[model samples]
Target chain A: MMGISEYFESARIAYQAIIANKTRAFLTSLGIVIGIFFVIMMGWFLDGLDNAFDKTINAIGTDMLYVDKWSWGGSDDWRSVQKRKPISYQQALEASKKMTTAELVAPHASKWGGKITYQGNTLGSVSIVGVTAPFVNTPIGNLKEGRFFSETEDVHSVEVVILGYKVANAFFPDRSPLGEIMRINGRKFLVIGVVNKRGTIITDFIDNQVFIPIQTFMGMFGTARRGVQIAVKAGSQELLDEVREETRVIARQVRNLQPGEEDDFTINESQMFRDEISTLRLYVWGIGIGLTGLSFFVGIIGIMNIMFVSVTERTKEIGIRKALGAKNRSIMWQFLVESSTLCLFGAFIGFLLCATVIFAITSAFPDVDFLTPYVPLHLLFIASIVSIIVGIFAGLIPAYRASRLDPVEALRYE
Target chain B: MNNDIIINIEDVAKTYQMGAETVHALRSVSLQIRKNEYIAIMGPSGSGKSTMMNIVGCLDTPTKGTYLFENENVATMNDNELADIRNRKIGFVFQTFNLLARASTLKNVELPLVYAGVKKDERQQRAFAALESVGLQDRTHHKPNELSGGQRQRVAIARALVTKPSIILADEPTGNLDSKTGVEIMRLFGELWKNGNTVILVTHEEDIARHAHRIVRIRDGMIESDTINPSPAEV
Candidate 1:
């Protein structure tokens, strides 16, 4: 067995050899640096996406269900869904009257690509939603300024509207848009409230919309052409399944579908979104991990090449040490230590570079809640472990070759 | 004489395969070396003097017959055992003064003790003493490239002496130095031998071999003569 002192001597020799060829060591380790950087960045990106998804899902309400003619998951063929009868406001009213497990019910009608103007500024391609007062009770309904339209406003067809965050910002950059009158589809409507900024990467379109009472929307756009969506909030998270079944049965009865007949309405929930997001997450991780794996493989090859070159260059040194009473294990350890030390240097540089990039992004976009400011400690730990493993694998063949060298031939090598 | 013998060889042979032909590097040879004996092995190229030196140094196992080092059968020893024997019992000096090129003279001298698992402080102390014996105490901090050929050789000699081995085996120790520096190295070896250290010199030069008390000459893979110097040269 080689003693600890011998191992230390080997490490010292290995360090000297690396110091002697600083440029070669640095160049060889560059692959490792890039590999580690890509791995950590990829992890951070996926983690950010996950964080954004959680925030969006929570805001949308996990126990909420949307009753619509079309499924949000697109599981039903579009032609068949289009052929189904549109869900009408009357049907929504009937379903709400019959529901027992719902905490609140919001029946809404929305039109995309609508135009709104304030002063001389015109914002096109805005989503215009007509909803009841119960819509304000949802998580995304928190107001940043003023108040939501009241039930009296809906009954009287009052021209009061609530602007989403981005719309409010676009119309009034330096002041509040509440109580200000804005033209919607060429008619003057008072902005009663401003919804808080609730935009996430996956659900950003919600911030580009304005909401008004459903009666006013029917007076302007007419209710005969499009479908009405009924959003039902379960009394409790534990009652979501029961509420959904109740809504489904009520919606079928409102549509007057007989027993054994297929229901015309689709009930959508946050779980559908979660399932789709998870699949998307898998694809992201697969591609990200695959790409990082490729980079690490290339890094291994780079380190292996350098280790072979180092062994060949130091053949005489190996022979000298062997002749001076070094065992084969000692020679093997020397080369292994050299290669691993180089990889560790690369990992450290990679970590520093990654940290700088994260810091720059967080500093630049301080309000970007999706991007965490600091690299997670586990990422650093993983980078170190990955680098050490790469170093060992890369050095194995070359170190073995060095250890197996015949002392006589090595001593004679120039 | 039998009890004093530290190395014993009986009908040792070494063979090699060169492509399609078998080459007998050492056909058959037997020799014994006793304690504190200064001897030289002399031969031209291809005369198997290097093969003999390799066998004696425990760097290679003999293909046939028995060889003993202090009554231990070295021919049957495994690689680890042979390495241990070499580390503890024999010191090697090379013609090229094979010191680590990047290490200082002190580090070069400490190489053997490092392999021997000696503690750091004692290794340094003994290495320094060895360098002092070779009159290179002041040059211990210089790298091999910074030193003259003679000084590098002295450092190599210090490394060889640091282990306090049973025998100092030198292969053409002065072949790379000038005549004057070569004489200085030989004088140092003469003093080491006078201090009761066993020394073995492998060289082709008659002048360098004359510093040893006994001369063994080889020709065509066999010993041509083994004779005492009667009056060894005093360098």
Candidate 2:
């Protein structure tokens, strides 16, 4: 028997049958469409979340690594991290001078709950960070409207403040905020700059905080000798590891740590961001693949159901073909082609719908990565192959049943 | 004539289980039919004429004894083997004009070749030739439902004749048609037989039975008589 020719003929016949019942065929494809729709949508949502996090990381500056006595955010130890001593200015200065890889090193001092008042309008209980001019070059102090303060202001320990964009907007919406006088914790400070409208985890980055020169913050709010952390910049991402190691050695010396004692600080930068995203990606693929699988199952079910109906409805046809000379394999292939065609069509429609929805949502709120169109070629390719496999399996029992019918009995069938 | 018997039945019996009891559909029936010989089996309901026809068509296996087609014993044949002989050797035309209602006349005629795994061009050409023989060439593309009863029966005859099987087992092939349409269908069968094809017509009507050169009467699962019609029914 010419298997190829037979299969093609049978497939053509089967396709004709499906076309004859367009409403049923289209409805069946809908199941597959809905299934793929959700799966692709999940991909877009995941991408949006990833983009938001990436923006946050970029906002913190690529050049600067946070050198702190403990990791930022919550503690892994919880108890031990709470008991740790703060990084001192002398240790920071020593680490800065020793690390040849560092392009800029600025000691950071923390002053909590600093109030900012501009005339009658005021925002209270905001985090007030005090750091030197290094932040000016780093992305952390990048501005939209006004420039960062000069190194001279930082050295003089001048009473000056840089308002966050939202903070300035709240008080001086129509006017330039630069050179305006604001009081930080009841102390007069000349507004030197306003930051860009940066996004945040919860609060708007610009609206939530105030920035003052590190030296002036220590002199006025707390102790001049105190340092909370150091904002250290490695010249490039490649130099970060080397700069971190050298700073560790210098910090140990400055802290007078005995040999073999665990180093007191970690250099937190790109690696942390990578690690976080790596973990996040695992969760994304896990959930995404899982949910996608469920929809694919629905596609399979639709194919199976349709094929079963097709077998019965075309009983006489199958019988007639059998009488004519159809091999069992040819009959099987006919239904297989039919089912796979339906499902693959569904996948196409589903992805199209996903694209339309993505575009619509992104147009409404332009932050969405609408054009990303994350159709993993391999996954989709595999899904299509699997759909075909499922198509064959779904067609198998029915095709067999069809081919097994007695020609004479079927011809005699009512 | 090849004079070689293409089909032979030796004391073949078939019993069907109907709920509580087994009904002997055919009892010790033995017959031999040569290729290209027209014959008719005639009997009323419950006479087992249909059962005998089924055994001859390879639609059912016998309960006892041997059935042979072209020296190949059919009683011991597997489903696939029986199917092979059925598809290649025996064509069937039903009393009710059992054409595939949804398929075109060409497709209905091509049914056997499709099973035979014939190529598309060959299947279509063969079906067209068969339709042409039954004078259905113009209506080849029409569905069974779209055709009149006479036309539908002609399509079914075309389907039965398309495979060019050894014997055409037609069971009351014209029972569904009006008298004039039925006579027309029988005339077509006479033409098929004249063209050197073996035609086996099963009908209880004596006039229809008379159309065949030989008639075998079956009653109570037994062959009551076999005789040649002196003056057969005129087409």
Give candidate 1's error at residue B133 in angstroms. Answer: 3.7
**DockQ by candidate, in order:** 0.63, 0.31
Q: Global lDDT for candidate 1?
A: 0.88
On DockQ, the leading prediction is 1
lDDT of 1 by residue, A1-414 (tens): 777888898778767776888888778888888888888887887788888888777767888898999888777787888889989989888888888889988899899999998887899999999999888987667799899988988999999999999999887889988778899989999988999988787788889999999999988888887789999999678999899988988998999999998878799887777777788879877887787778778888999998999899999988888877888888888888888888887898888999999899989998677788868769989889889888988999999999988777788889
Alpha-carbon runs more than 4 Å astray in model 2:
A1-34, A50-64, A73-75, A101-228, A231-244, A259-264, A273-360, A367-414, B1-5, B8-11, B17-22, B63-68, B71-76, B119-122, B219-234
| Best model number under TM-score | 1
